[model samples]
Target: MIEILSPSRVDRARRTGALVGDILQTLRRRTEVGTNLLTLDRWTKELIEEAGATSCYVDYAPSFGRGPFGHHLCTGVNDAVLHGRPRDQVLADGDLLSLDLAVTLDGVAADAAISFVVGEARPAESVALVEVTERALAAGIAAAQPGARTGDISAAIGAVLTGAGYRVNTEFGGHGIGSTMHQDPHVANTGRPGRGYPLRPGLLLALEPWVMADTDQLVTDADGWTLRSATGCRTAHSEHTVAITEDGPEVLTLPRAA
Candidate 1:
């Protein structure tokens, strides 16, 4: 379903966005070599609960994933990219980690994701992958203006990822988000401009740009949730929840300090 949030809801959405951002930032600061994925999940749960918010993923059940995600956060390391279910694994130096989070506060929801390297080592390829996704996310956000079509955003993101020599995957991409986590108006990572859903005030969209180093193909891990690169190449993902307004796009998921 597509939801055009009301003014009050939009205000609430800002709060929800801030909470999500702060939690992710906190987790990033606490992560390091030997950090366990479950530790991150626990930290996320505590933060969410402390804020009096609810997790959009904890009980999430969808056809594509194993029912009841049962985790407060998604931790994607190295080859893992999307729907990365937290497991009994410890991070290693130079490991690329991606954290995706969504939460609801005051009846509104926001979603965001960030990918970064752990410890002191920064592999050139890993750094490049993370940088490209971040750049693509920024390009997508820049294209999110009132009256602009979703395709415009998609094209902008696609240009960055493709230009960086990464393959784009459309099977899973950004989508409308509001009171609930995922909504209508599917936003692919790549598409022709001037097509798809028309943007308007009160519309909220989660724009995510993710890519694999070598191929566009993905393989599901035995856990039935984590999505990894077919070639086992490193991957990266960046995302933000944006609200379209008469003044242009307002990024709600930025850290409080940003």
Candidate 2:
């Protein structure tokens, strides 16, 4: 469903977006080498409750995933990319980590994701991979203006990834998000501009651009979540929830201090 936000709804959405962004930023700062994936999940739960918000993932059960995600945050390490379900693994130095999160605040929802390297042992490939996705996300957001088509956002995102010598994966990309988590007007990582749903004021979209180091294929882990590169290559993902305004796209998910 394509849920358009009313003025009141958009206000609530901004609140929701702030919460999600704050939580992700907090988690990113807390994550470090030797940190267990479960610890990260626990931290997210605490923050959500402290903010008096609800996790959109706690009871989320989608067809592609094994019923009930059973976690508050998605912790993707190294080759792990989308839908990464936290596990018992401890992050090692230089491990590339991606955290995806969504939450509902005052009945409105927002979603975002971030990828980073764990420690000082920065691997050049990992650094490059993360930068490419971040750039793609920025491009997509720049294209998301009122009256702009979803394809424009997709193409903007696609150019960055492809230009970086990386292949784009469209299986699971960005989507419309509002009262609930995922909504209509699917935003693929790559597409032709001037196509797809037309953007309008009050429209909210979660634009994410993710890429694998080499292949575009993905395989689900046995845990029922944690999409990984088919070729075991490292991956990265970047996302943001934006609101379309008469002027342009507003990134509602920036953290408080930022």
What TM-score do all the candidates reach, one by one?
0.99, 0.99
Q: Runs in model 1 with CA error above 4 Å? A: none
What lDDT tens digits, residue by residue, belong to model 2 across residues 1-258? 998889889989998998898899898888888899999999999999999999999899989999699999998999999999998999999999999999999999999999999978989999999899989999999999888899999999999999989988889999999988999989999999999999999999999999999999999999888899999999999999999998899999888864
> lDDT (CA) for every model shown?
0.95, 0.93
lDDT (Cα, tens digit) per residue for candidate 1, span 186-238? 99999999999999999999999999999999999988899999999999999
CA error at residue 218 for candidate 1, angstroms: 0.4
Model 2 accuracy (lDDT, Cα): 0.93
Using lDDT as the measure, the top candidate is: 1
TM-score of 1: 0.99
- After superposition, which runs of candidate 2 have C-alpha atoms over 4 Å from their true positions? none
